[model samples]
Target: MPGILGHRASLPRQLAFRFLPDGTDDAAVEWTYHDLAEHAAAVATGLLRRELTGHRVVLALDPGLHYIAALFGIFQAGATAVPSFPPTGKRALARFLSIVEDCAPDVIIADTRLADRVAQFEAELPASAARPHWMFVDDDWFRRAAGARRPDGDTRATVRTDGPALLQYTSGSTGDPKGIVLTHDNLVSNCRALEANMGYEPDRVGCTWLPPYHDMGLMGTIMLAVHGGWPLVLMPPAYFVQRPYRWLKAVTDHKVTISVGPNFAFDICTSSITDEELATLDLSSLRQVFCGSEPVSRATLDAFRDRFGPRGYDETSLIPCYGLAEATLYVSGKRTGSAVKTVWLDKAALENGRVRHLTAEDAEDAEAADAGRAARIVSCGEVAEGHEVIVVDPGERRQAEPGRVGEIWVRGPNVATGYLGKPELTAATFTARLADPGDELTYLRTGDLGFLHEGELCVTGRLKDLVVIAGRNLYPQDIEHSVRSAHEKLRGAAVFSVPGESGEELVVVTEFRGTARQLAEEIDAVRDAVTAAVTAGHGVAPADVHFAPVGAISMTTSGKVRRDATRKAYVQGTLKKLTPAADALPLSVR
Candidate 1:
């Protein structure tokens, strides 16, 4: 039997990937179909020799052809793949270790850079958790992967695993990391759904700057390209962040039709890149650009489309999508070629479970009285074929009323079975059933809150991130936006609720790009502006506003502000506090 990616070896000399360290159109390295398959076959042989056929193997490597081959090789060997987040520094290694402990993998295959740190991580973990054997994918390993022995009789393709094919750990942006167990069938089915939903084009290239550790990168770009047999152009996330123009340049040079990223990538292009760069980019070849793994901001969408509209960019190419690791990615998204749709509502009214689409006059009048309070939500599109998406009050375990705000729940063949080594969590998160007797399939309870409007899904905010105060519901993104606009000195913020004397009070922790020297003179003014903006927008001032320099706000590897961790740091008096005598501020958090 032909394995999922094994058939791609026969595509002969078909180009598989052209990667650039700086994400430029210039290729630092390139690989063909045979290169990927043969190298993966070599890695599979090594895994089989070590008898890791049914065990969990962690992959800790940066984005490149070699990393991709290791992931496919694990799948080819019938061993589950667990890709670790590329560690940011020594400080973040602890959190990375916690993830390994939770998954309890049998082995860790790491890139050359992390080989030494893995030993440090092992020394820190408990004896039981430190039992995982380490395999380094250094230069020697890569050379061996090129010329290593190949297992006979298709042993690399055969499977004996009782568990799923892929064990993807959540990025821990919203909560603790857990291994999402996705089977081979689940991944194949989801890819088919993606092709059908996005209107797959056979001729165009696949382009991405997302890191391979995240689901959007691993499944959407790497696995999606391999399965669809498309030549792909891949780049690391840092390269794109450093040179935002490179992504568009590669897309234009390669005639890439498909790409994916969070809303921020498009926003960065609109804000940071110069007009000279824009003139050089011709993006007419792009057909479907899926934005997910974070909230899709309408302002960001409009800015990107308008900024590039002159250069043959189509508004219909922008697709806002909703998915989670538990669903093996690509759960539901906008139909390709559909116009981007947005609904504006009165921010005050939106807190009360009403989705009232506002007229232009109403929105202007509302914003005039209460700046930064207009709520504009973009739809995440219709549910995928062979999937059921519903909104239910998680506390009641029953379906929500049409157009009523509730937790987003999804059930489909593409949803993963459960979280690895977490029976209670798996049951609570994956075994959700609608109170209705008719539909018997289990639903995965996405902790996100959203409502359906005329059949399209509109995600509001995470249930965990919702800020409640004085019997009103508030989304932190709106509050943070208001704060950012209220003061030029403020660069970033984390907004949440803390217990007050009467009820839950709003807490806003601000991070500034400027120095404490400037803040000593203007801090009072900044505070007043923030307070006034919060009062005008949300009808209440923040209970406490603490200012910290950049990097004071905790965040996950995916760049999501870890609100819970931030709150903990704030309560413990650990978040870096700005003082008049502190001299200067550190640069922005990376």
Candidate 2:
């Protein structure tokens, strides 16, 4: 139940905090536990003088030492910290403002670079409403606020274990974003659980390049390193996107022992790295490559191991993990030194609620006949030490048999209480129940579709209409179902979710009984109709719509459309399709 500041008082004062090995920025940013405590006290005093207590304070800034200081300062002031990304465009900016309006934060501590943009957006607001006071994180502000005064020695204040510690907004892949309320106890419990599960030591060195706005980046990389008293190397997300090889080079250069990212990052690095860059790097110190944030692919992992093995990378370093913001950070992870295990199954049988593991020979034969494409699913390993996982049926009343797909439910001291400000939704999601009839416990519904296979969790899909593309979620069913109802021929049509270089997109593929001559016109008509429907329904535009002849759409033996298969085929350029119009409408059109 103790807050981060409370722990800091008891933690070692001389523990190493962070290391900046890039040598690009000249910022002398290094702090010990004592320095952190002093800076947090200064920040707390500044906020109290401004009459900002027991209110939400948004932290909208880039990653830096000042950002870290301000984050702890907000917590020390007994206020909820809302960590958010910088607004990129008009729509994103509007959404950010809306969230602030709803939360009614007392103040905002933002970077100087975004102060003008925030002011311009605020000016557009209607009159007669309370507006958040803003303060810029400039050099003058830091000198004034951090050097002004300190909290009274006799005033003893601290956050309870049940008090809100953070307000993390959902990715907004669905409708509007919801604020996930995380308490001090929830974070402390999860961090301890992760430490015990992964066997983290103070001597370990962590390196990561994921954006700080994400949950994995904030909790897994930053909080874990700080709480464990380990030295950490930080890299911007842009640096990884621009040159992925630099990430590997950093690992070898710094002798990083632990790293994590999505599966796409590995695939990109493996496919794009040059032989010359690989020759100069030494990766022998790399002990764990934590893979998560998306579906873990065995092909991607194997390819990475093969590509970097000769470069001193260990084959057993790849560890697939599973976690979400609802549980703070981690749920499960494979053992440290074990090679990833995958089971080859008959694709047809899997769709019919039956799972049969196949022999290696049978797997090879199927791949050979299908031009070297096999169905290999990897396990996410066992649940963390203090956490419990259960596979439950739709009624939420009974557990499913092994190998039978169902919703994944989690229960533990680390599970969060509920969403912020939505009591009905909170009651619906965080339910009270026991695994056994007489056991006293409760579980949180994850809304993730998966099943237990030999005591390992195998995630298949999502129960919600959430589409995850390139490690981001997208809501397409709401748009697709609306589109279908708008056009008569498209009724009951299937909407396919696809990710491109830009981002995740929605593709409405409708089947119609028509000849090639009429297909072109029908396709255009359907595209226009669906585009309008989605724009009106969701305020977002569809990327494209392709019309297919009756029976042209691929389906499983049981007649369910293989949406994943369809997406893969489209990405590989193997899907036969009707011709698109020469003058296709732009994405902004309604």
Candidate 3:
């Protein structure tokens, strides 16, 4: 035991056991380090008896002590853990089966509910191939497993640090999901980096309701708690969705110091909380509210702070961050106690590959200048320690200047190896370079578009998601923001880039807060405003503008807007809408 194994050996002894305060069966449910170690050994022995070693194991259990025990057990058995969301429908189940076939896991450990689902999948899978052995997370299994002896030596010794520890499947952003291979070193390095970046202490406590299937939920919250020996309070994602303020109340109840989620969670919490609820909630212990996994909206952050600040929520605790699964978790985060810094830029300059700063007064004079200006696109702070981030041209051959927008590339110990079983894509994405003398540099090509200003990373938009029209790059965020701001009736909108017969076109999908006829007028007003804004601001017009009821937008398990899926649904005529129309082209184009 050397680098990380040495640290792991002492963790059980040094750390304290703290379960979810509100929801456990009994006081005995709180497992100590010695108890966890013994349980892990029992699961490991059980797995070894089944001849399942050095293979992938999938876990589809809800958030609880057993789920945590299963994860540690898989690692203790020298196997890779593939944690995924429970299959929702036939299509999603088929996709999971396809992934299982590809990965060829040795066993599947799921809750009783999920086991039934797997049994249904078994009926469909061929009999020739080796079917995964199923293990149900139940009281019988726990009782039988608890009394087993602990493994003598390091189970992780056989597992190299460079080898894969976790297989995180992407949310089918491009198409079908592909597992991202993250190594032990990558995980440990990121945890250590984030711990340092967030200034985690031994006494700190974290509360999260994010689904474990999401990268941020697993790596950013769960693993970080384990590695740092912090007390963690876990809640079901459904619980949070049904009552968003429960997350806040949980924090208030537990005196939780840290929490994190996407922008939508904040929006939900702000929208759902009544004034009386806010008055009773005490969030004084809250220090860091990390926001990421989607486009971070300053408006959402500001509204949440304004609504809750009176109830002991600190406005300075707002920490807007930037990260993706490819890089493991976080890349950059704002410093604690700092207001989120946002810049307004000329929209035309941004579209035409130019970055020009604009002031509010200057924006009103010229439409191009107004179009050039983007608002409250928060600065995600400087690169994390032990990481190097650079903005490069589309080809990734040359570096971009400070004020120019380009693709973001990162070289760091925290970066993952690549997507599992996709060698061509791995080669395309991860590259060896000699950017500096004797550098031996390896960089991960993030499809995110951003730029560096005064050594800080400002994420503009996704490279693939960028809408190129009339030789300009129109980011979806800007379009969505413009449409939402255009009408008081249309709210909670998402704009996406849709391909048309001619080329790429902008599609604005909004949720109307009124009746259909009134919503139609509001939509028309949005369309006109968006068209004028895009034409004046970015020299392009939207191809179509659509209106739907509230809650029409699709989100991932982590609450990220599924722009690609939304576009697909719209193209297939599957999207439900009150009124959808093809708008007139920009006057400049006609």
Q: What lDDT does the true structure give each of the candidates?
A: 0.81, 0.68, 0.74
Query: Which portions of model 3 miss their true places by more than 4 Å?
Result: 1-29, 88-95, 124-130, 148-157, 173-175, 200-202, 359-374, 432-440, 484-492, 499-503, 511-541, 549-552, 578-590
lDDT per residue (tens digit) for residues 1-590 in model 1 = 12656687775578888887678755467888887877777677778888988788888777788788888889888888888765556655765677788888888887776767766677877887647887777557868666557534453757633347888887664336778888888888788889888665769688988878888888888888887888899888888878888889888888899998887688778877899998898999989899988888887888888899999899898889999888889777898999988877767767976666788777877777667467889999999898989899888889887656899999888789998778999998998887777867788999999888878889998999999887788998778867877887786789998888898989999997677787776776888899998888778789889989977887655556778888888888888977755334333211
Listed in order, each prediction's TM-score against the native is: 0.93, 0.76, 0.86
Cα error, candidate 1, residue 243 (Å): 2.6
Winner by TM-score between candidate 2 and candidate 1: 1
Q: How many residue pairs clash in each candidate?
A: 0, 1, 9
Point to the candidate with the largest TM-score: 1
In model 1, which residue pairs have backbone atoms overlapping below 3 Å? none
lDDT digits (tens) for residues 189-307 of candidate 3? 88877876788455687888887868999888878877776667777777777778778887888788999999878877887788888887998898888888887887787788888
Over the stretch 306-375, how does candidate 2's per-residue lDDT look in tens digits?
8988888886777788888888878888888887878786644554444667787998897676532235
Off by over 4 Å in 1: 116-118, 150-155, 160-163, 173-176, 368-373, 436-439, 582-590
